[model samples]
Each structure stands twice: as C-alpha cells, then as structure tokens.
Target: MVDFNSTSFHPATFQLTGFPGQEAAHHWISIPFCVVYITAIVGNCTVLCIIWAERRLHQPMYLFLCMLSVNDLGMSLSTLPTVLGIFCFDVTDVAFDACLAQMFFIHSFSFMESGILLAMSFDRFVAICNPLRYAAILTNPRIVRIGLAVVIKSTSMLLPFPFLIKWLPICKGNVLSHPYCLHSDMMRLACADTTVNNIYGLFATLVTYGLDSVFIILSYVKILRTVFNIASYEQRLMALNTCVSHICAVLLFYVPIIAVAVMHRFGKSAPRLVQILLSYACLFVPPVLNPIVYSVKTKEIRKGISRIFSRDFL
Candidate 1:
C-alpha cells in the first residue's frame, strides 16, 4: 500500500461528494443507498440466473432481456465502489486515473444500456409486427452480433472521452459533482479549452442515445399501428402489454436523466443537493427497478423464479 504521507503522490486526486450541504447525513442516507445497491445487484443477478437456467426462454426477447440484465449488473458494479468509499468509509479522494477508469466504465455501461434498449425495442418490433419472421430476423448469431455491436459501439465512442478530459490541466481543483465521476462534471474542472471535449461529448450522446431513442419511438409507433389493425380487444391488450416492461425500463432510465440534465443546465441556481440527488437517482433507480418490472410484468420470468425457489425448497 502506497502511503499517502510517505511519498509524493501523483495523478492529481479528486474529492468525491455525497451531498453538498448535507455531509453529516451522508452516512444516514447510505442506509437506503446500501439497500438499493444490494437490491439492484441481487435482482439483476437473479434475472440473469433464471434466463440462463431455463432453456424455454431461448428466444430473441429473452436473450435481449439477459443482455439488459448484464448491462444493469455492469452499471451497478461500476459505481458501487466510489459510492461505498465515499459514504461508508469517508474515503473521498480518488486518484485521477482511477476516476477516469470509473467514469469510462459507468458511461460505457450507460451507453451499452441504451444500445441494448434499442435492440430490445427492435426485438419487440419483430416479435409483434412480424411474428412469423421474428426468428428468421433475430437469429442466435444475429443476436450475438447485436450484443457485440452494442459493446463495441459503447467502448469505442467513450474511450476517447477520458483521454480528452485527462490531458487537460485541472487547475480548477478536481472536485466532482457526486460520489462518482461524470464526463460532464469532470470537464468543467479543466483549465484548458474544452470545446473539443464538449463537442465530442454532445456528438457521442446524439449518436448513441439520441439516435437510439428515435428508433425506439419509431418501433413503438409501428408496433401500435400493427396492434390496432387487429380487431379483437383482448389481442390488442396482449400485444401492447408485452411492451409494458420495456416502456417502464425506458422511462426509469430516461426520466431522471432528463431531470438531471435540466437541473444542471437551467437549475444552476438550484441547490447542489438537488442536482446530486437526481444524479444518484438516475443511475441507481433503473438498475434496481428494471429486473423487478420485467420479472413482474413478464409471466415467463416470474414462473422461472418461482420454479427455481420451489425446487431449492424441496
């Protein structure tokens, strides 16, 4: 272990924040944080295990759900360390390189989640609009390809973001917005020109989430059209119901994200605590709630869960 006092340190450590003015309550608030973190990890892991064990779910939809769970797992694990370090241990100072690594993983997984959502929407599209050809369209190899593409797209685009922010001289003092590193939060601390960073960051967001969101919306619109063309009310309800979990997942991921963005841009005069809380909520809520939504909304997943438990009990 490198002693902080013994040798001259490097990489310019940054202080992570819990709540700006409510530092005293950080530990107390950690109770809920700990609960959410454990629930997200355990819930996503359980979803993954169920999908893996049950061969009946070996379809495009279930495969995409597995990918979503894996991405959620990555997102939870990505930020867990810094959160626990700051809240539980009061270890706030993080080496700059470590911060960048953490940022890369967090943002990369975020982008991956978006990509997976888009892929999931497409899976729903094919299943609903072209049920006969769904298997032909989303073959096992094709799903693997989409998964690889999501990983590649996220990693490649976000890889430069850290290097872009890192070389900049952090003369503004390396304090971050929340208990973790965000590219937007980190860029503000740079003394050097951030025009390139901002441009590229915006570019990445547009290309990734913006484009994905558009396609997702279009896919749903088409699904609705297809569903409505059918005469039977029960059939329409069943068709639309299939999308409920994914829609909830989308909202859970995006709503607070929009709140955080709005707070940062327009709510500058807003309390630092407000912004921090929303940021944390955006990252934490989706992973924790998604597995629950899918497991509850999708009967197959719930049945698998019940069967697993019943077997273990026996």
Candidate 2:
C-alpha cells in the first residue's frame, strides 16, 4: 500500500548464518544440505525428462507432474545460491532489497507447487471417478490455462511481500533464522509493528495450503467412493493404485509444513536448528521424494527410466 520503492533505497545489509551457534561446523553441516539440493534438482529433472520422452505420458496427470517438477526446480534454484553462500563462502551479508526479493520468489514457488499438486489431485479424481470425461476435461488448452492460473495466483499472493518488507524498518536487526529468507523469518526481524504483515502471512497460508489440502482430501474421498462402487476388488485396488504417488507427494509436502507451523506456534523454546531443519525439509522433501514415489509407484515412468538408463549404459 505504501510507496516504499519511490526513493532511491539501499537499506542496511543482513548477516546470514549457516548455523547460528555451530559456526565451526558449517562445512560439515553443508554436506547434508548439498545432498538434498542436488538430489531434488536431479530427481525432478529426471522425472521431467522421462515424462517428455515417453509419449504414453502425454496425459493430464503427467502434465501436472511436469508442473510440479518445474515448480520444484524453480524453488531449488531460487534458494541454492543463498544456502551455498553461507555454507561455502561464508558470505552472510545480503542487501535489503535482495533479501526481500529472494524471500518473495521462494514463497511464490512454494505456493505455486501447492497449486500444482491440487491440479494433479483433480486429474486423479477425474481419471478415477469419470474416466470417460478425463480427456475432455483436462485437454492441452485447459491444462495450459490451469498452469497459467497457478502462476498468476502464486505471484498475486506473494508479490506484496517484498514491498511490505521494504516498508519495515529492519535497521535494528537483520539476522534471520536460516541462511535463506522467508516471510516469517524476515518479519520477525522488523523494527516496526508487523501486525499487518503477520496477518497477511497467515491469510496467505490459509488460502494456499489450507484450502488446497481440503480439496485434495475431498478429491480422494470422491475417488475412493467411486473406486469402491466397482464390482471387482482387484479393479478397485488397481484404480486406487494410480494415486499412490500423489498420496506420497502430498504427505511429503504437508508433513514438514505442518511440523514447521507447529514449531512456530508452540515450540518457541525448541532449538533453532530443529526449526531450520524442518523448514528446509518442508521445501526439500517433496522435490526429492516426488520423483522417487512416481518411479516406484507408476509402472510407465519406471520402465521409461529403465530404458533411458539402459541406453546410457550402451
């Protein structure tokens, strides 16, 4: 609401600590972080490549899977620089504007990922409940619109973050909880009254994560009802089998998210590293696990990956 961007602005820089107290073991700490980041990027990319190479995967579910991978890739790339900077170079000082921008992108991609997952749930619901209409309902043009809408929604929800943070007088304290930036982490350091910022953050969380989780559950409920109506138990099991990867992905994303939220609300006395680890997992786990879940659960993706690896060996 305020034109904080009007003036030539260069706010004071902030220090990013890899581990607040255990600064001596930063390099050792980086080992796990490096593994997670590399795995997320490579795993999501492999999923994308496999889907693209296999014509049989040219369906609504795979398209949504592609969207999830893209969002995961964006998020990993977004936070990689800051995390590596703190762990490797010990470069902790980040400009005010840069910090705000990084936080904005990180949160935006996170919300975008949630939206993509919701779309994937709808894809599963349609395929399971009304198989005959799946193609017509999630055609290429419609899928494109849905993707665009997700991007728009994510941007709209998080676009104000930087500016809101800009208006905050953070000159008093710039140190954050983690090496990377986050809305909650950044807001806690603000010198001004952050009631509005806190409200907006909570509101955004409910709109994105809360509503999406509800719809995902409902989609599965309807799917279950439809599957159970089938005469054959084998047919029902096969129908539900298609959703195993999606179910795993939803758990991977939400479990860490809920953990972080609970820690923030009730675990104020908890160790800082615990909070940081949970937050990192909230972002890292889904990307790393999504591809693995799909590969293990979906026969097509597994065979496609096998063929690609066999060719590479030759």
Candidate 3:
C-alpha cells in the first residue's frame, strides 16, 4: 500500500466485499441478485420500448415514465459489474476510477429517479387538480425541458463527488462495504478530514430528497383537495385511481431510501447483513417494481405490452 499520509497518495484499486464473512454463501446469494438484475433490465427495457412504440402514450405522464425507466436501467447497470464480480467470479478488485464512476452514475440516477417521481407527481397534480389546463401546461416542449432539467440537476449535483473523494487521502484500507461503491461508503474510508464531503452530501440529499419529497406531498395535498371537491363519488375515485401507479412508484422508491437512511443513522448496532440487505433493497427494489407496478396498474401500458407481444411472437 502506498503511504496514504502523502499528499499525492491515491489507490490504484479498491477491494469490494459482497457479504461480510459470508464468502461461502456468495454463490448462493448471486442467484437472487441475478434474478433482480434480469428482471430490472427486462422490465425497464420493456417499459421504455412500449412507451416508445405506443405513439398514443407520448404524454407527460408516459414521458416521465420513459425517463424513469432510463434512470432505473442506468442504476442497475452501474452496479452490475462489481456485483457480478464479487458474487459470480469472486473478483473483488475494482479500479479506483471505475469505482468512482460507478458511484457517480448510481447516485446520479437515484437523484434522477427522485426528480422524475416529483415530476410525475406534478403531472398528476396538473391532470387532476387543473384538468382543463393540463394539456396546455405540459406541452411537448415543456416536458422536454423538465426532463432535461432533471438530468442536468441530478448529474450536476453528483459531479463534485469524484473530485471530492480523490482529494482525500485514504489511510484506511481500500475495502468497500458492499459490492458496489457508494459515496457515503467511500467517504468513510478516507482518512483525511471529510467535513466538506459530508456537508456537500447533506446538501445534495436535502436538495434532491428533501425538497422533491416536500413538493410531491404538496402536489398530492392539492390533488386530494381538488378530488374531494368533485361532485360525483365515481369522479373522485377515478381521479384518485389515475394516481395509483405513480403513488406506488413513489413509495417503492422512497420507503427503502428512508429505511436505509434510518439504518445508517440509528441502526449502528444492526447486523451487517441487515445493513447490506437494506442497501440492496434501496438500489434494486424500485427498478424491479416500478415497471411491474405500472404495467399492472395502468391499462394503457398493459394493452401496449400485449400488443407488442402479439405482434412479435403470436
């Protein structure tokens, strides 16, 4: 190991761990991981393809979904290599730069997902709360700008992470906590002062998770008020029904995130397996479930999927 105390010190490679002290079970564990990866890839790709092929689905809601699918795919592929390496091939070494890149993409995509969900919430808000203006407000040009804003905002927020990480000298062993690299985990390994990193991380978290979540809640509050004012019971149910998929998607994305955050903060005495499993849930669950939830809950998506399958195979 190079002298980490030196100003110019940097690690060439970092060791990645799958399950701590569970090497024997890595092969077994790879099964579920593989299943999740396969499902996430196929599911998200199918969503994207269906949304793309169904010209009728080129609305603000489906457009936001397309962005979500893309983000899910990015997050899944970002972790695939290190995860497969550790579990399947037993190769744990990852180049430092590669590790940083993976961390960057994973976190950026995560932020993008949050932003997309917030945008979806806004879509629902406009559709239900202000139905007449929905079309005029969420035009194709406006949707494109929102999508671009989400991408740029998420990527820009995370852009400083790599340089910030590289600046710190890591006297601690370069062994990552999980198969995939994470910004928080990387900061933990650095021996130098990480106050700036921590502060910036907190800032990013507040900007993405905190602000986006608040906006989503406010949008829903407005939606509920608008729905309640409708005269007919069936109309209210129909209005709320339209949001079921998006609501599921939001909860699926955020609940695990909240759990992981709580575990990191309060579950210091929690088992290592619990921590790792929760981390996996945060990364894997949303991507796998979002597409399935949308397909199950939205009639249009179901029809689109069936149409594609019938045309291609039957």
Best by TM-score: 3
Q: Please say which candidate is ahead in TM-score: 1 or 3.
A: 3
Reference-based lDDT, each prediction: 0.88, 0.86, 0.92
Specify the poorest-scoring 10-residue window by lDDT in model 1.
1-10
| Model 1 lDDT, full chain set | 0.88
What's model 2's lDDT at 48? 93
Candidate 1 pairs with clashing backbones? none
Candidate 2 vs candidate 3: the TM-score winner is 3
Give stretches of model 1 more than 4 Å off.
Answer: 1-11
Compose the digit string of candidate 3's lDDT tens values, residues 1-314. Answer: 53243545767788889888889988998999899999999999999989888899999999999999999999999999999989999999988889999999999999999999999999999999778999999999999999999999999999999999998887688888989999998888888889999999999999999999999999999999999999999999999999999999999999999998899899989998888889999899998999999999999999988998899896
Clash count of each predicted structure: 0, 0, 0
Q: TM-score for all predictions?
A: 0.95, 0.95, 0.96
For 233-294, candidate 1 gives per-residue lDDT tens digits of 99999999999999999999878978877887899999766777788887899899999999
What C-alpha RMSD separates each model from the true structure?
Answer: 2.9, 3.2, 1.5
Q: After superposition, how far is residue 173 of candidate 2 from its true place, in Å?
A: 1.6
Q: What is candidate 2's TM-score against the reference?
A: 0.95
